[model samples]
Target: MPLSLPERPIILTGDRPTGPLHLGHYVGSLRNRVALQSTHQQFLLLADAQALTDHMHDPAKVSRSILEIATDYLAVGIDPDSTTICLQSHLPALADLTLLYANVVTVARLERNPTIKDEIQARGFGRDIPAGFLCYPVAQAADITAFKATIVPVGEDQAPLIEQTNEIVRRINRQAGADVLPEAQALIPSVGRLPGIDGKAKMSKSQGNTIPLSATEDQIRDAVRRMFTDPLHIRAADPGRIEGNVVFTYLDAFDDDHAVVADLKDRYVSGGLGDSVVKKRLEDVLQAVVAPIRARRAALAHDPGHILEVIRRGTERARAITDTTQRDVRRALGLFTLH
Candidate 1:
């Protein structure tokens, strides 16, 4: 089911333009983001600057993927008319706000962020973690406060980033003797993570287990055909394990026919159905699921200029709010030089 945000709060969420979005993004956020636009003032940031925080050495890759990322957002149901989609770099206010937020936060505090710790371990950036990577939480605080966003939808791994934003919000509000920024709240997803096709931890681009949103029909078919299944269930008569099985995970995510899925589960557990048969069903389900999305994406791909116009208009609206927030922040910091 798509997520719902409470009335009376602004929502801000976005993806870093490090790569094209994939199936995991659909399950995690994009699906709900599409639905939320009708009900709330949603800001979808194409966080190119944030991508550069880690991809400084690969500017070309970052530059190329921003268009791909925006395409993915449009392919899904993110209507630019209802949702404001903007480039992160276009908002110069975010960088200005980040500078002020950094002073309010301590170095020790930044180092202890759980998300940063995990990213550092995964990327093998021991002591050489970029200063930008370490200070990203402050940048994120600027992202939230720049738009006065009160609700931030994030996965569990991103909860620390939201907390960091709220901390700055409280600190800045108190320090200036004015409640200029509202404390941003983290709406953590109830489901923890989506496993990769390899049945490993989270689905990731570096892990080579993602099904790209822009993937062709043949590519999706081949990927699903190669999906991991229950290793212990070697023969048709062997009882299959449902828990931690990739096929069942996909079914839980995509298949709306719970009764049919239950029947398949029973067949597998009762030592009659083979793993091949179950895999075939999973393949069918996945194909049925993504076919319409692929078709819609193809239709939109025919008009690249139209897509860019949507983003251009969205960027303007986004800049309007950010411009006001930057003015207020400068006033608070005495950066404004008005006579």
Candidate 2:
């Protein structure tokens, strides 16, 4: 079996295992991955190899997070027995694929990648950016093509990354005079990207603005209490602006009470509703949303060994599929017998 795939197409998606997943992950992709598991052949990667591209000095952080990442996946209802949840480094084929892909792609193309540019600037790499960090998009292409992925679900900001993968696919197929590597399409999520508590564009772990998946109840409450709201909304009776409000944004993502959210927006926008009331509503929404996941994660935390076993078995299965693809890829490039 080529994993559980839909009659339509196969789906491939994953995250770098640099840290535990959070609410942003849940609202962004994890929930969708859970739904896709029964319909599409899904490969959920623990991208430690990719993590090393940036976290080269911190193997210990990556090591601790590997199992935490797995537990988050399980708690969020990713059926590991059905979907392949494996480490990126375990699949040797991906490394080989990356080497071949690197040759076809130029440094100029890598430099122009919007994602890499922002990453390099954010990391404050003055002139000495790591070669691995620069070449990671190619590695991601290898990750996708290693399993012959047809569909990759990602956020809107990642559209350029998928485009790079498609370019590599087309170039490799042209050079080989055959379509061995299928062009992968992106499935952009419908929701707007979640902002950090400070209203930053993204809720990143590094920015110290993320709510951890394993955060304690007190931590969650504190985070909520300090969540940034519209600066204009100072007094309870003041006419608050809801257009760029972070609390309303959280409510949009987490609160199931659409009518209530609508009412709150109107009241706040018009006048007399305080930010505290909206914040309290958001707290209720988040707590209701995360309670079960927290409970599930707590239960699984007791069986760390079992979780590792699941990851090991999934890695074994993923390698089998990637191996076949690698062999074919090498043959296409006339490198199988040579190396």
Candidate 3:
């Protein structure tokens, strides 16, 4: 039910199969997952159940995106050998854990969770909030505690989920008289949130501002060209502000050439830097970053059997580990076990 010291720390992170992951995911968590696999024991969950919280109406979209999301993972170099790629719906333990955790965490606490509150407002759920939607924090605690994940990669906005998970950990341990769940630390990425191509603060598929991982060359170019820039800086001689400018932000995140980006920023601030010039630079940078991922995702898409097999193998492995955790939790909580 809880984590023990292993040779390497356990990290549990995943994406909901609501849509294809985009540049926001690439910079925020995908790159870090690639690097962490070698040194840490990682489990990448295909969170189809969690996807259902809001997407229950359109099951087809979620189903289609499962393969698409898995393809994106392999396309981005997440080795199955190093990282276990598991399906959330396949793990019964998580459902059991969620139910148990719900009994411990209060409704008022769930309502007060900032991340859930923001999402509720964003989705306009209001008083009509889906019970599952309101219970996302509990489900997330289950996901984290299921594998006894000690290191969870999350966005800064998601830090509260991790904090809530630890709170459940403490309460469960108090009842169980043992550490039945381990506290997870949020491992935030260095690069912050990538703005939408429209210059919105958040990039999202639902918002139609996302550039998907499978975006084509033309799509990539079109997105970069349409990127938001300083309206006042219409002329090449006029100074531009980088604060809300999406092109420079992309450059800052994607362009590895510091001196070049620095020069561009200085010129943009002072004057004489055209939006088109910086846009071209961003387009080029994005092309290089997304091209390889697109190609790999295409190749992976051809073999549905292979992707299924990988998910199958990893899910089977995860089932055993999670089953053990369930038994531990049930026994710890003093729940009667027929077995």
Tens digits of lDDT, candidate 3, 60-92: 999999988998999999999999999999999
- TM-score of every prediction relative to native: 0.94, 0.96, 0.98
lDDT digits (tens) for residues 215-334 of candidate 2: 777778888888888787788788887767778888898888899999999999888898878888888778777788889999999999989999999999999999888988788867
- Per-candidate local distance difference test: 0.84, 0.88, 0.92
TM-score top scorer: 3
Instruction: State the lDDT at 256 in candidate 2.
Output: 82
> Per-residue alpha-carbon lDDT of model 1 for 188-219, expressed as tens digits?
76555788988998899879999888777788
- The alpha-carbon lDDT assigned to residue 198 of candidate 2 equals 82
**Weakest 10 consecutive residues of candidate 3 by summed lDDT:** 1-10
Candidate 2: 10-residue stretch with minimal lDDT: 1-10
Model 3: residues >4 Å from true position, as ranges? 1-3
Residue pairs in clash, model 3: none
lDDT of 2: 0.88
Pairs with backbone N, CA or C atoms under 3 Å apart (clashes), candidate 2: none
